[model samples]
Target: MAAPTPIDQITDKVERLLLRHEELQRTNALLVEQVHALQAERDSLKSRLMAARARIDALLERLPGASADERKERT
Candidate 1:
């Protein structure tokens, strides 16, 4: 059996570290993409909510004002 040299061990360690760094970089990019996708979905939902609110307001405006007789009829 032969013992490994110090230089060879250092080289192996450096290679492993570089591989880990690359993996982390790829993971970060994926996370960033996911964040952007979620933000776009949030904006779309907000727009839809605003549009629905406007439609409801318009419908209310078109109807005649409520009267005491209409309120009494409900009961």
Candidate 2:
């Protein structure tokens, strides 16, 4: 069998590089989508946390004999 010419070798290398570039582009797109989903999830969790904190504060305010000084001292 004849060995590959330099041009043939370079062509093969170029093809491989193009395939790698395409694969990396696909992977990057998926990563970006995942990051956006995670960001939305984080925002939802933060809002939920804030709502829960508000409810706790309201409950604490309603507690019998729970003075403002005691709440400040506990924290």
Candidate 3:
């Protein structure tokens, strides 16, 4: 059997690199999708937190002797 020539070695390496490049591209796309999903989740959580804070503020306002200045000092 004939041994592989230099050209054959180079071609084989190039093919392997191309395959690796394709695999990396697929992995990068999946990571991007995950980042987008996480960003949306983070935004939703921030909105929920803001709503909860508003409700707490409202409840505090209804409490007796809970003056605006007192609230500011507590914070």
Report, for every candidate in turn, its global Cα lDDT versus the true structure: 0.85, 0.93, 0.94
Instruction: Give the C-alpha miss distance for residue 52 in model 1, angstroms.
Output: 0.8
Between 1 and 2, whose TM-score is larger?
2
What global local distance difference test value does model 3 have?
A: 0.94
Per-prediction TM-score: 0.73, 0.93, 0.94
Task: State the lDDT of candidate 1 residue by residue for 1-75, as single tens digits.
Answer: 678799989999999999999999999999999999999999999999999978876665566886656644643
lDDT of candidate 3 over 7-71, digit per residue (tens): 99999999999999999999999999999999999999999999999998888888898789998
* Better model by lDDT: candidate 2 vs candidate 3: 3
Candidate RMSDs in order: 5.2, 1.0, 0.8
* Model 2 spans with C-alpha error above 4 angstroms: none
Error of 3 at 55 (Å): 0.6
Count of clashes, each model: 0, 0, 0
lDDT of each residue in 1-75, candidate 2, tens digit only: 999999999999999999999999999999999999999999999999999988888888888998998876764
Error of 1 at 1 (Å): 3.7
Cα lDDT of model 1 overall? 0.85
